[model samples]
Target: MPVSLTIIPELNLVHIIYSGQVTPKELFEETQACYQRPEYKPGMAEVSDFFQVTSFEIGYDEVHEFTSRSKSTHGGVDIGTDICLVGSTKVSEPAILMYEGMIAAKEIPIRLHVLPGYPEALAVLNLPEDSLKYFPEGCHTERHLL
Candidate 1:
């Protein structure tokens, strides 16, 4: 299956769901399409679920380009990844490298989060599961006073 990217501005997050069948090139293309919306500016933060990815790595050039573009177009970027059994074991290493690359190239801060799963990712975003009362299977249904 092709990778899919979902951006939820209201939640201030971007979610990338990959099926492990696509190449990084395809993934980046899809990501660009998702962010091409006029309303999407630079500085958007995102969370990625690579649970379905069989194996992957971000090359140095790719990392530099991504971080540079994000910083120049957006204010900064945060990338969160699932650290469960199916995700990246070298998550922290890449995250730090990407962050440093971004800082050095564009002076942008790229934040990284290594989460166990969706619930943990949401928790890191402060959108805990307890916040909702009746959301769908993976959504928060709790009511909040906005």
Candidate 2:
């Protein structure tokens, strides 16, 4: 899969790594799975790595719909942390812009941070630079899929 999601319970963080080309279906599925995790709290911070994604198949409409659908489940009232997006790929920026727009329109309680790397993501979430090691190097994403 091109899109993957990892939820870190100890850190109260969600990590999404997108490699190769991404499809809308895969993105939505992984996202839903991420939120369904027992460790996934509303106020948890997130780091999304899209630098490896060569391209994305979804457009503004799909992005908007995806976000709209996510609203009922993704946000938690106590969501105390900001959502950080780390994407270096060209496709990452436009998607970020579109999603930001959707978030603004919906007035979600989450602060979306669009960055180019995990270092900036950690900084945005006020986490230590070395904290990344705490997260699994493997596919920690699937643990939340069920």
Candidate 3:
């Protein structure tokens, strides 16, 4: 699979790693699958790492529609979620913008951040630096070590 999801119910966080080429359908389906998981809850935080994604074919409409339709079975429409996106590439900017625009329209508590990588994301999310261990090597900076 191009996208993998790891839900940490203890911290109310979700970790996502996406690689290879991803399609809009696949992305939506993967997210829906995660939302259906037992650990998913309202106001859960998410760190979506797209650092490994090589390429993708998506447009604003697709992203907007997908996000607008997100209503987790357990987490109702008003539920909030904090999202951090990891990646800094020319190709990633559009995705970030689309997400921001769509999410803003929802007026829910979903907050989004774009970080260079996992190290910065941890700080932004206020997670213990040691939590970086959950990610693979190179996901964190030496300063992220604690």
Q: Write the per-residue lDDT of candidate 3 for residues 3-58, one digit (tens) a residue.
A: 88888765678888888887888888988888778778756788888878887677
The digit string of per-residue lDDT tens for model 1 on 40-110 reads 54555566665556544566677676666555555433542221111444533464455455655665554
RMSD of 3: 2.5
Each model's total of backbone clashes: 13, 2, 0
What TM-score does prediction 2 earn?
Answer: 0.84
**Which of the two, 1 or 3, has more lDDT?**
3
**lDDT to native, each model:** 0.54, 0.73, 0.74
lDDT of 2 by residue, 57-91 (tens): 88988888887875765555654457788655677
Residue ranges of candidate 1 with Cα displaced over 4 Å = 39-44, 76-86, 90-106, 130-146
Q: Write down the worst ten-residue block by lDDT for model 2.
A: 137-146
